[model samples]
Target: MDLGFGREKRLLTPQQFKAVFDSATHKVSSKHVLLLARDNQLEHPRLGLVIGKKSVKLAVERNRIKRQIRESFRHNQSILTGVDCVIVARRGIADLSNIELRQQFDKMWKRLARQRLAADQANSTGQTNA
Candidate 1:
């Protein structure tokens, strides 16, 4: 498994997850609901995804969706700098093909850009080396 953003050091822990969830700004895009998050407000890019069982009950289905999301970020992490993004999968996701998934992600990112937090290379990098 590709784990995530490459390095394991930067992945979100339960503590970090809580921090962002408690204070991050949020928006709903046509594709998915984007959780625009920050820690104490950290100033680097970070990302997390939540594909619920309700949306894709089978592990295989959920994992496939997750792989799609992670790969999207791994390649486009630079586009979103300072803000942390969390994509919580909804039921509709179960029906999407890769093309449709990308379309949805694009929509979500475009919407997220409006309220984005700037990313700084220093302090924290934009991704977790998962």
Candidate 2:
């Protein structure tokens, strides 16, 4: 698969970030991460990372978390289509290894994808019945 974390696959502006936070329809939380997801009109998935200094403390640690998150998202882009996701780093997340972080993110991404598929099916069925 083509795994490239391009600018188009990132939530860049304040308005875009606010839209995801304000209208999130799915959320998945793990020990050190909380993923908030919203359905978007686009054909591909986009990601936003919120590794605040208040939570992570050091810039090096925060950058590591962001890199891991982005890498995981890049590899799972196909399954995450049509969704905008924001990953918020919780306190103590900096201690987790990259493997553990990827595993948690993978689980949450699958759950979010399933939720989106179910919602789409329900909408399609309702439209057909009407």
Model 2 lDDT tens row, 20-45: 89989888888788889998888889
How far off is residue 96 in model 2, in Å? Answer: 0.9
Residue pair clashes in candidate 1: 6-129, 7-129, 7-130, 8-129, 39-42, 45-126, 82-119
Which residue pairs overlap in candidate 2's backbone? none
Candidate 1, residues 1-130: lDDT per residue as tens digits? 2334754314467776666667766555454444455533444457777778877888987888887777666656555656666666777787888877766776666556644533333225536543
Q: Scored by CA lDDT, what does every candidate get? A: 0.63, 0.89
* Model 1: worst 10 consecutive residues (lDDT sum): 117-126
Per-model TM-score, in order, reads 0.71, 0.92
